[model samples]
Target: MAGVGTVRSIISDSLGRSVMAEQPPKIVILTAPGEGLPDGLEALSGEAELLVAENGAQLRAALPGAQVLCVTDFRTNAISEAWSAADSLQWIHATSAGVDALLTAEVRESSIPVTNARGIFDRCIAEYVLGQIIAFCKDFAENQRLQQRHEWHHRETEPVTGRTVLVVGAGSIGRQIAQICGAMGMAVDGIGRGARPGDNDFGAIYAQADLISVLSDYDFVVIAAPLTPDTEGLFGAAEFQAMASSARLINIGRGPIVRTADLVSALQDGEIDGAALDVFEQEPLPAQHPLWDLPNVAISAHMAGDFIGWKRALSEQFITNYRRWAAGDALNNLVDKTHGFVPSTTNR
Candidate 1:
């Protein structure tokens, strides 16, 4: 309501033919302070007016008259703070798959359409999840530890084959995990918004409401769901207690989806065998966090979907969508603001 104005339409002329307006649409690229701008954005030169904003002040100045917002820094709150200045905003594209950080009350309640880099991260994140699953079953963590002490101790390790995996979110990333894991002879099931049978990637899809009731059945449980009101703090003591004691947990999803203190308690109490966490409630995790000292946990700096050339990939996806928008074509990865994600319609 702050940006009160009729939504601007730049896709066509009075004739209704798909065409760019006489004036190229202005695109505002938002980045974090000290972070480099996304690569390959020079492609937008001559096609549109490109403005860069690294903070709320810059963004507020850039938002007026800009029709498209490209959020390269998904973690920033600058958008929310500057939403009132977005008088001309018609679309917002998030470089990251998750748009939770960008979905402020003003942005969500507004009529502006939001899109994300959904397909861009599916394979990379799936691979990261698969690697963690292998590490846990093969005892790769212990192997590295014994090597550090220069000790040669024989030990039996579990096999990933024949193990059961439960993916808590049946989105594109989760399906990719199922595809790769199923290729390894493990059985995979998925949890989604509703129950369904005969899913292409998963053996069966169970409604999210059944999550805790079915937790004890799997050897591994993965959190790949986006962070929403329904999913935040989804995994805690009660959920951990529902899993098999031999089960391991892997989370490549947004942090805060799993409660930090509860996860620490679960690991300390041996409620679960181990965990591999890429995202956390607090980034950098603080030097003295108990999770760092725990041998059963694998920690990463929220880099699961970030691979070499990822920045360029994000830029390219934005460019592609921009072209579509200019030509009045449907943009890919459009997020449903109500649900907080692009609802998964196909298995990737």
Candidate 2:
């Protein structure tokens, strides 16, 4: 994987020095149809021949001599469908943190190295989780509603300090969330692929198997896990029922992680107090979706990790990694193809 982006062909110059062959490495930037290219991509213009592909046909055409593929449109499967045409493809990079959509069977089993924008989102998402927690604990939503109605009603709100927080997926993002929540005087524990104790960030790290057993104990439960096969639809009616009625949920993870219908039922039945959801099973959740009208649920498009100029940030990250690739250095944020994420231990 290290040499994938290195100039493969070499020749001797007049001075008897080794020089790269005349054929320059071609890099393909895969974007969604009609979407503008990522900012700062011009940084690579002098290093490699850059081509943009917005669909399968374009990707297939661009992959023949392409050594590197930068997938700005992480959600599309065009790459999987056009993989056979990747005759010279050595490395693939996804600008988005989640690579579930890109990890097709062929891509996962192949030796071609896969990387993701993992660290880029961790802190931004951590801040989002913290903001949502504060909003929920302080009942800011209710205050907004009361203000909208032009009524003055004084009420007591819950305090975040000293409350328990259970963060599922104790990876980099989860650890950052723990760091911030802990700073706010909250007791932070985590659930990950396996259980461990005395972790630097979490008080106790429990395995996924223990999630239900520990559900009722925490005042706040955050779904920060990746959307692997094991996590899709992980939280359903029973899981919701296991939660304390006073507890709130924050889902900045993939939408399918929680069953929408079951979640709605739980909220209506007081199975859980409230939820702050950024991602949903459906993008641009239907205008008539009940989740939108639910008083206890706060919803947003999947923008928790997207701040202003984030596209430029993502492009800059790729440029930094591209330099590493050219130098035969181990790329950062290398995804464990089998696991669909950069293992927490490996990337950090």
Candidate 3:
């Protein structure tokens, strides 16, 4: 439990000034037991009252004096109640990058500072994307299916060596994907909210306006951007139509980025070669959804970045940030409630 103790100590040290003012706050975990608390935080169970409340009532009961609330895949109703019941709440940290699920009307309306595990999964997810691309290009899935049927079929395997990849986000995750693709000898282009000059990692970086114009140029398009107002439905019919006939798309960012119906149409029409989607516009992807039957589409249960050590990594990140907070240093990856990320003014 030394890890937990260390986390508590770091948090205490970070809040030393506030604690000295007779305002020490409790930390609450408002996620299901199945979701698992971040490692190192369990040590705080003794030093600090650790409450794992999965429902609104339990959350409300535990929120009276809580300062920091860590939430995973639990519902937003509990989050709303916790925020409403705890007037002393100072910060909230989501275990996932996309906070949209936790953005209940009440929580969003509150002034509490919220942060997410933004950069932690960048490398892991980029690797997953790369692996999927390689698997699809090498026809691994097709080969396995053919083998299972006891049929030996020889087919030409495509190489991703000279393919062009259009990364639709220049953030940490997108940048990581671009770097990996570049290392594989693939030409990489990036699109983000702003266009920065001389971003060597990418062959070119363009603003949102240029997405359509350049969509047809890339052999593969990967979406790793945040789910924001501007990015909702960013890839629709027109965007898919603009892609090359042999192009494929991969979305590891947020669901709803590509309209599912339009994507189905594109796949059915052979407008694009294939797609690999880890996230869906709807969770659990509904059992009867037609997407499940698409031969060219691979559907994952939104689990690209979930590695075995995710909890430990999340704990380490929290600990580092807690130490910085204790030292009165500026926090890393602070979320700008208004514009999401404060729009990295200096374009990359």
lDDT, candidates in the order shown: 0.89, 0.89, 0.79
TM-score of every model versus the real structure: 0.93, 0.94, 0.87
Q: To one decimal, what is the Cα RMSD in angstroms of model 1 from the true structure?
A: 5.3
Model 2 regions more than 4 Å off: 1-20, 346-348
Using lDDT, rank the candidates from best to worst: 2, 1, 3
Ranking by TM-score: 2, 1, 3
What does candidate 1 score on TM?
Answer: 0.93
> How would you encode candidate 1's per-residue C-alpha lDDT over 207-282 as one tens digit per residue?
9999999999999999999999999999999999999999999999888899999999999999999999999988
| Of 2 and 3, the candidate ranking higher by lDDT | 2
Looking at candidate 2, the ten consecutive residues that score lowest on lDDT are: 1-10
Q: What would the TM-score be for candidate 3 when compared with the true structure?
A: 0.87
Question: Can you write out model 3's per-residue Cα lDDT over 22-131, one digit (the tens) per residue?
Answer: 32337777776465565777654544556677778887888876767777762355676555688667677777777775666666777877777887788889999999
Error of 1 at 90 (Å): 0.7
Rate residue 43 of model 1 by lDDT.
89
Q: List the candidate 1 regions with Cα displacement exceeding 4 Å.
A: 1-21
Measured with C-alpha atoms, the lDDT of residue 148 in candidate 1 is 97
Per-residue CA lDDT of candidate 2, range 1-348, in tens?
Answer: 335455566889899999877565799999999875678998888878999999999999889978899998867979778998999878999999888888888888889999999888889999999999999888899999999999999989888899999999888888899999999999999998889876877899999999999999999999999899989999999999999999999999899999999999999999999999999988889999999999999998899999888999999999999989888889999999877888876422
Can you give the lDDT of residue 233 in candidate 3? Answer: 98
